[model samples]
Target: MEKQKELVFITVIGQDRKGVVASISGYLYRKDVNIVDINQRIMTDGYFVMSMAVDAKAATVSMTEMSRELDQVGRELGMQVQIQHENVFRMMHRI
Candidate 1:
């Protein structure tokens, strides 16, 4: 049987700006994280919001390290970035 993919959820929120997607995606690419799906938009208030589903089975680092590094990237972009396991995210958002 095939190994199951380790799914992760990534969320980004902040002011609208260039390079946010590029920078994040580039970093994931380098880390061997595959972005399975992504959705982003600029809200009426001009804030940028993005959510991504990623497969981290091939990632070079652990989730804790990835979160720390992504946090640094978010700080540089004046944004808040968060990562969580899919199950945890779902549980947190469940109605």
Candidate 2:
């Protein structure tokens, strides 16, 4: 049987900072997650908004576990982070 692919989407919003991406990317890296796509932009309010899709099946990590870790990262970075399964994300984002 072929291995299943597990994907998740992560969003981070906060005041623009130098190490925001580094911090989040580093955390994901340590968890062995493979970043599939990443996009970040600054809003008129000056808050940085980042969206990323990661593949966890390659890293053998669970969505719940990764989400917990991301929550910790958000707390440490003083940002709001949301992690969601890719399917749910797509459904919610689809018009």
Candidate 3:
């Protein structure tokens, strides 16, 4: 049987700054959350927004814990970050 991917969607929003992606990606990497897809851009006024799809099947922490930790990391980076299960995100974001 093929291994299933337990996916999570992560969103980050804040003023553009150095190391925003590095800090979050590093944290996830250390926790073994594999990033499946990433999209990020800076608005005309220098605000940054990012969305990522992560494979969390092998992560060391649960989704809730990961959210909390990501929040902390965002605070450290001076950003706002949120995470949700892929199903939940897809449901809410569906057109």
> What range of 10 consecutive residues in model 2 has the weakest lDDT sum?
57-66
Write one digit per residue (lDDT tens) for candidate 2, span 46-86. Answer: 88999998888766467777788888989899999998888
TM-score for each predicted model, relative to the true structure: 0.88, 0.85, 0.86
TM-score of 1: 0.88
Misplaced by over 4 Å in model 1 are 44-46, 92-95
Best model per lDDT? 1
* Residue 11 of model 2, lDDT score: 96
How many pairs of residues in model 3 come into backbone collision?
Answer: 0
Residue 77, model 3: Cα distance from true site in angstroms: 0.9
**Can you tell me which runs of candidate 3 are displaced by over 4 Å?**
1-3, 44-46
Q: Quote model 2's TM-score.
A: 0.85
Count of backbone clashes, every candidate in sequence: 0, 0, 0
Deviation from native of the Cα of residue 84 in model 1, angstroms: 1.0
lDDT, residue 19, model 2: 84
